[model samples]
Target: MEVKDNVVIITGASSGIGLATAKLFAKNKSKVVLVARSKEKLDKLAVTLPNSLAIVCDMTNPHQIKKMIKKVLSNFGKIDVLINNAGQGYNSLLEEIELPKLRHIFDLDFVGPILAMQEVIPQMRKQGQGAIVNLSSGTTRMYLPGMSPYSSIKTALNVASHTSRLELAEDNIRVSLVYPYMTATDFEKNTLKSPRLSQSASENKDFGDLPPVDSPEKVAKMILKAVKTGKPEVFANPYLEKGELQV
Candidate 1:
């Protein structure tokens, strides 16, 4: 779909891919709504973007997700796109996984996006056409040690995204998934790391052989491509083809 003048809600808009996406959409003339728990950052970003709104929200909360959608609709009168980008990373070996932390990541990386999708569907349906771009990770295909919890949650989101695409096809709603390889971002710094896992990850030889890291701006362009082309999946890794994973 054409992004120009479209009302687009982007979760995790305070940083990384979401931040780049918000800026890119704003540049393209889309009405951008920045959503994140970082109130100051969102507010600051909103002010810099033309026709943008900042909504401080914790994506893990269903009520907050619902309220965010309502506010978007109230201000825009219609929803054109929903970008489910708010998520966190967790790292732990299977035996070392913390249940509470696992559950929190699950809520952030999987459940929250699904809830956001549920909240926006009615408005998208009312408009008779909309696009949803879900941010997934290339690590889902890497199957790296200490990444099971995080990758598994993203894998589940992959399933939801593709299934939603098929289910929403008749309604003229498009659901797309953007898979970003390791990008230069604060994700690593923010990730929940286990002591043992961190030490092991530091020694993992495989990481040293991986391709060059992608930038957030490159991933942001792939997201824009996903929405514009309505492709089921878009990859930020140049080494990857549509269905194949190189790393």
Candidate 2:
């Protein structure tokens, strides 16, 4: 689909990849709707971008997600794209992971994006075309010792996104997944660490060997490419040699 002048709503737009995506879409002349919990950051970004609106929203709340979609419809008339980028990181051993923290991460990483898709699908169906991109992690395909819980949640989203691609095909709503390797972002700083693990240990924990870290702008471009081509999958760093890295 053509991105110029299209209405695009991106959740978690306050910082990192979401923020970069919002700016890139704006630069391409799309009407960007920036969604996040940070009012100051969203407001600051909205004014700087042409034809942009910022809505403070907590993706974890179904009510808030619904309201955000409604607000986007109210302002833009039709929804062209929905980017599910709002999520948290969790790292803990299976035995050391706390139940409540695990539940919170599940809510943010899986449930929230699914709910947002539910709220946007009807509008996209009415319009007869749309694109949805869900941000996933490269770690999902790796067997990281302390990352199982987080990767499991992303794996669930991967399944849902792929399933939606098939189901929404009839509606002309394209659903895609973008896998990003380690990127320069505050993701690590905001990650929920296990109580049993010290701060330094969690920070210093290595993932064996990995590829070069990607930047937020690099992933943002892949996201834009996914929407423009309606490809089912896009990878930030394809050197992992995975067969799924096509497009």
Candidate 3:
């Protein structure tokens, strides 16, 4: 669970929680591998961190993930921690949501990480020790009107986290799930990218009111701390700590 000297792989590390965790790990003197679709961004970030490797990977593709795992194991020797955090949400009413868009959410938020896990776990298991940290949302505990699809897939991930934990524990591998409250990131921007949605909301569309969000950097720091301590679940914002915010 120590952050120092560990080889950590972070999916979706181009930005947001993934990027934050990469920077935190590098700062903690860990060897870090960052995976994302943006080559330029990953290159820039890799140059800034010592003992870090930036890999342009699309987790959705099984081939890309396989090659990524090959490149990591070849370069860094092994991965001690795998962070599955690349996901997007679909925030729309059930009636307005198209079937394709709904499926995309399930694929990205659930299937993508699962594929990455399947590819990397064997290497981790071969080493006889590893840790997995999954990114989840608080919407799993509450029904946010416009988030039916998003919450559904996220809940599926939460369930995967639990079952995967029990299954992987026998191998001396740890699985940790984090349900971070809304943070100031590109989550909504990514949500609007559902290909199945024929009619999209205007860029300025307002969704009445929602809970206040926090900074990605703040949440990223909390995420690293939680992982280092091996906590099963960590609330970076702890919005539910207050009675009114309870889900």
Candidate 4:
């Protein structure tokens, strides 16, 4: 689980938690392949990090994901870590959703990660030891009214990670998940802004401020700690404080 010299592939690496994690990995001298649709951000990050591969990959597309995985493994020889950080979210009531947009969230949040996992697990198994860290949400633990689609899908992801860990454990592949509250990221401000969620969310704007959210860079450090330590999960909040966790 040592970070140094490991080849790690991180989806959604153009920004937010993914970007932060990429930088952290690079700082620790891990060769990192940064994946996302934005070539611009990826290129900039690569310029600053030695042994960083920035591939403009759209994870939702099966073919692109396969190509990206192949390219990374070819360049790095083995995939030591795969961090499933790319995802989408919806903010709306169940009744007011359009078919495609409704499905797109699950496609991005659930299906895309699974597809990426399917591609990488074999390589990880070959290595005889690897880790898959999934990025989930605190919304599944806490809640907000218009986040039904988001929270449900996020919950499903963690469940899948748990089951996946049990199945992959025999091969020495570790599956870990991270559940973080709202962190300051371009992700929220530039959300798909699904119209279906908007109409309902506007009326029920029940989003009262809770605890202060952390910066993505800070959250990413916690994720790296989990990666190095093989922790089952990391919660980016004081709520998982001293007295709250079960020993």
Better of 3 and 4 by TM-score: 4
TM-score for each prediction? 0.95, 0.94, 0.88, 0.91
Q: What residue pairs clash in candidate 3, if any at all?
A: none
Clashes of 4: 0
List where candidate 3 sits over 4 angstroms from the true fold: 193-211, 241-247
- Write candidate 4's Cα lDDT for 1-247 as tens digits: 9989999998999989899999999999999999999999899999999999999888778888889999997888899999999877777666655677768888888988999999999988988899899999887775555667788888899899999999998998989988776788876655555565554533355547557668988888888977887788888876533323222
Is 1 or 4 the stronger prediction by TM-score?
Answer: 1
**CA error at residue 39 for candidate 1, angstroms:** 0.5
lDDT tens per residue, model 2, 200-236: 5644757566566789999999999999999998988
- Candidate 1: pairs in clash: none
Q: What is the overall TM-score of model 3 with all chains considered together?
A: 0.88
Q: Runs in model 1 with CA error above 4 Å?
A: 200-206, 242-247
> In model 2, which residue pairs have backbone atoms overlapping below 3 Å?
none
- The per-residue C-alpha lDDT of model 3 at residue 145 equals 62
Ranking by lDDT: 1, 2, 4, 3
Q: Residue-wise lDDT of candidate 3 within 55-116, one digit each (tens)?
A: 99887777898899889989988889888888887877777777887877787789888988
The predicted structure with the larger lDDT, 1 or 4, is 1
RMSD per prediction, one decimal?
Answer: 2.0, 2.8, 3.1, 3.4
Q: After the best TM-score superposition of candidate 1, give how far the Cα of residue 208 lies from its true spot, in angstroms.
A: 3.4
Q: What value of lDDT does candidate 4 attain over all alpha carbons?
A: 0.83
**What does candidate 1's lDDT look like per residue over 1-247, in tens digits?**
9999999999999999999999999999999999999999998998899999999999999988889888988888988999999889999989999999999999999999999999889888998999999999987766677889998999999999999999999999999999998888888878998888677553354665668789999999999999899999888986554345445
